[model samples]
Target: MIFPDNRYRQLRAIQAEDFHTCFYCGCIATEFDFAPPKAHWQSYQYRQLSADNLQVPACKECVALLKPCTMGLVQQRREWVHTKIAAKYKKAIGVYLKWNEDELEELDFSLHHSIAAGLKLGEESHRRSNFQGFSHEIDGSKVADVLPAAMPIVLFDKQFDSLKDAILYVCKNYPITQPKLVERLAEQGNNIEAVVMEIQEEQEVAQFQRQLKIQSAAFAKKHNQSARFVSNEVERYLDKELAYSIAEALDLLYEERVKHYR
Candidate 1:
């Protein structure tokens, strides 16, 4: 696991607070990240950049997030990592930005817990992303915030604190179940109204199928034909003609086939 000294940056903490703290997110550092990374250091052009070859303390999560980054400058690399952190917790950030402590207090236990968890995550991520570098005591200099602004979740011309809230609201208003809605949303993308319509159409088709089976069984019993035979014929006719209803298909089957037999 040892890296070459010239190739890998030397570990250094600029300030006392920087020790054991993630340079990217301010979390407790469990690992070290090589600024410009070892791979980038291989390039002669990249090595020529006035990049500080410093190994900085980073949490496991930040290390993983920076795996693909090749920025040579430490500041640029830090900003890149912050961007990833913001994107990674965008939903949580939305929740944090949308609701305050007072609003969270009004929610029921389950909902309150759900939102509270999201808010906590959002707060941590928010802090980590905005975290300025450790203060420099020389003249008491401070760093500017690095976190990007977050956008709230919006649906049906309404804004939601989080995606979970939006999904809950949709489930309440629509006949679609939450699980099915979530499943379809993953398959169909974020068009909530379209997803609702798709589920409704599926329900209608399923209901019509059940009705057809029941009514066709009754028709089969009355006409002395096998239930499967009647159902199959009716379905075939309906498939041939999109406008044909089950009742119409059954009547046509009786007229065309049953009349000849009886």
Candidate 2:
């Protein structure tokens, strides 16, 4: 479902408060756009489709350019933004370096600490209570690192319909890296696959458990006894090894069924 009118107004207000210019091209923002192109909202179940989580101010140009963009393109844009910001800061630092060594050292230390503080504030800004309190304070220093970086854009040689496909591609191509960012991307890929596999396994196990429970209930009904009583009796009688053997046998039977059907 789409946002209601009142929620849309609220979202616009929030977007205006958070962003005055286009996030990508730095033009005066005409409207808010979803960073992940709202079109792909169906891909994420955990992320709430709200202003705070998804909205970013954009000019017409950026909106048009990015509306059809892939996740790889999005990652490239984000990294470009970070690289630009870092360059700007470094340039300012280079100007300061024209001073004596002592002054340069002081400025270097100050900038480092300031950036570190901004990073901390950006991280904490995810919390609703801290967002309003810290946003304005760190606005100047807040960079693309504030958001989760996408897996390396270079890995996407082919089109990907989802983030999972993009991540898997990256993992397959660049399995190891010494750079911290690449390492983090590799770890993220591993974690996503691990989590997805774990969830699938858990769901299959749950389905099997439910089927077993239903069978136990049916057996209990046949014997004119409570399901819980029958289940407990079965559990008591079926040792761990026996249960494992039964599961193995069931697996073989299912495999045979698949073979026969094929």
Candidate 3:
């Protein structure tokens, strides 16, 4: 999830309407209460790598949606570990605390915790605190990396939220082509490589589907199937890319076997 650090915003954005919706189920039920705030990183308070949490006022469906999100390979990366820690600290510790190098050191907390941890305090308060004393020490990094870094990120901003929505919602919506989608599917005890291969296979399947559509239309016209008329008309503009030479074979075929199929 793209947890926007409000510190990233150099300018204040007007929060005109409620945009905090259940990221997974697509429900905007702000009326739902935040249950006993789930603190994933509280145990790491003194740990070298404990970041703040990302608590949201989620309805039941939305909370359920997070189950899949909890499991990501991105969570396993070393960078992600420090990021989680940074995110947690960002949440639990406010901008007011100025660090002297001697007093504190920063590490990637998200990588340590393996997921974005939401602290006890909530959305509105999280925003106010996110910007109270912003720093921009890591301005050169990418937005995702910098969000949890010393750089400023506008936490829960609409644009950032939209990006988060796109990440989760796209993973949910596509569930196949998205790389994160495969990672989540693997975490659920599903076959990881198999899921990935399925995505790789999808292009072949789609090509076959189009091929069938075109071939069926041709056969229909020959045999006069009920839909042949419509198929022939549609065919005028369809099947424009089926041409190929004998020098190459389809992706899966051995040369001799390909000749048989041809």
Best by TM-score: 1
**Which segments of model 3 are wrong by more than 4 Å?**
1-14, 23-25, 31-39, 67-262
Task: List per-candidate RMSD values in Å.
Answer: 8.9, 20.6, 19.8
**Where is model 1 poorest over a 10-residue stretch in terms of lDDT?**
136-145
Predicted candidate 2 versus true structure: per-residue lDDT over 1-262, tens digit per residue: 3332221122232233445655554456686555444555554335543322245555675566555553423335444444444343442322222222333345567776664554344332212111111122122333333334333333325555433344445444543222222234345642444543444577677776686687667755654556776555454444444554333533443354333653
> Against the true structure, what is each candidate's TM-score?
0.50, 0.26, 0.22
Give lDDT tens digits, candidate 3, residues 1-262. Answer: 4343432221111232324543122245342221112342333334435332323333354344333333222222223323333355553322212111222224365532322222223232233322221112223422231234233223233132322223344445444434455244436433333444565588677875576566555544554453444344334334443453111212112233323544
Candidate 3 lDDT for residue 75:
21
Question: Sort by lDDT, best first: what order?
Answer: 1, 2, 3
Query: What TM-score does model 2 achieve against the real structure?
Result: 0.26
Report the number of the highest-lDDT candidate: 1
Least accurate stretch of 10 residues (summed lDDT) in model 3? 245-254
When sorted by TM-score, best at the front, the candidate numbers are 1, 2, 3
